[model samples]
Target: MTSAIRPPAAVLLPGTGSDEVFVRAVFGGPLAALGLPLTTPKPLPGAAVVDGFLAELDRLADQYGTLLVGGISFGAHLAAEWAVANPGRCAGLLAALPAWNGEPGPAPAALAATLTADLVAEKGVDAAIAQAEAGSPPWLAAELSRAWRGHGDGLAAGLRVAARRPAPELALLRGLDVPAGIGACTDDPIHPAAVARAWAGALPRGEYGETTLAAMGTDPESLGRATVLAYLRALTAEPVREGPLEGI
Candidate 1:
């Protein structure tokens, strides 16, 4: 009996305005358990430069050979897009808290636009961080504040890039045959459970799991560990065989 080969690496992508540190914490250890390399490039460019994100995935597919791509929010949508186009090379996709089909609502965009304008003004990036973090959950606020401390003024420009990026289209997601896992949460107002169900339905065979950032972020390690284990289990499960069988 021939044994199936496991994916050689897992490329993790972060959500909007988030850095590699956050993505790593979400998938690093589970990857370690599977003896797989984890790759997370820098935050993707703005809507005008979205190809940078695609290019990184393309490069990883070329280098890794049967790669499993995963992401959160916008990153998840992008991962799904790449998996669809390069199904032969992709092992599966793991997406967490995906957003609307394409483009965020006006509320998030307005916040991002405000931060961009504030950074350009005299008060500097510190003022913008303080303003934005004020309304966020305590753990998230702390993480964003830390990023600001490290990157200073540059973080403001990154936020604009994040806010303006578009989501993947439904046509892009409907025909994929690879295994997929949709990680969702109940408390997240932006990521509706209905969307998760829709995405799951599109795949030939996909798994759905639930989680919350409020709990996950509080202890970042737990989220990464849980996500990776869930993903590995799904990927190793049997694929949905198509075109009639001997038994049928």
Candidate 2:
């Protein structure tokens, strides 16, 4: 009898103010289809979200050896930075909706996150959700409604930290040799497609794909499938090197 080969393990982090539930919903189906079991850890409030995520990354690496790491928006930035720092450890990188590059500035996503955090802090979660729903598209409104409510005050704090977090430097990106997939949304303003294109362009082994928040809201699998399939294609073209893998 032939034995089944185990797929490499993947850990996906959620966007700012998002939780494991949200990440799982976004990635579970596509990852499972690709034979990867997804682990989405819930980050605690206070302390930079990136810091918490990095700690989780270390923990997961300890457990799994090499890992396939990825995330959405700010989470993507964290994953890319980690991958850059520990090039030999990552099996692959899936950076979805990467918001910006280089040092943090007045990026729209950051502004929105900060603004939303302020709103939540002053007006309260329910009021913030109402305002967001009123201003955003139906799909985004629904997503924020759920994620914001779930996060509560923590969401606000996370946004503040994410706003100040720096993006992976070009030097770091150029150093990454692992297979990478960048998922972008052409219409997204908060997470601009240009940034994704730049990231894909920068990485030596990066591939790019596109999916919309609307699609994700309706069929969460679309986000994962588009991104993972692109990464899988890159992996198939050039497999990961064999070595004693380290932690990221």
Identify the candidate with maximal TM-score. 2
- Please give the CA lDDT of all the candidate structures: 0.66, 0.81
lDDT of 2 by residue, 1-248 (tens): 99986565899888887777767877788777656888987877754566779998988888888889998888889888888887777889999889888876888998888898888889888998899889888877878788777776677788888887889977779889888888887878889888888898888888887888777667776777667766865777754331321110
TM-score of 1: 0.77
Flag regions of model 1 displaced more than 4 Å. Answer: 1-6, 44-49, 103-123, 148-157, 225-248
> Would you estimate the TM-scores of all the predictions?
0.77, 0.89
lDDT at position 107, candidate 2: 84
**Model 2 spans with C-alpha error above 4 angstroms:** 1-5, 238-248
- Model 1, 149-245: lDDT tens digits are 5545555555566566556566666677767777676666666766766676666656666666677666665555434434544566753232222
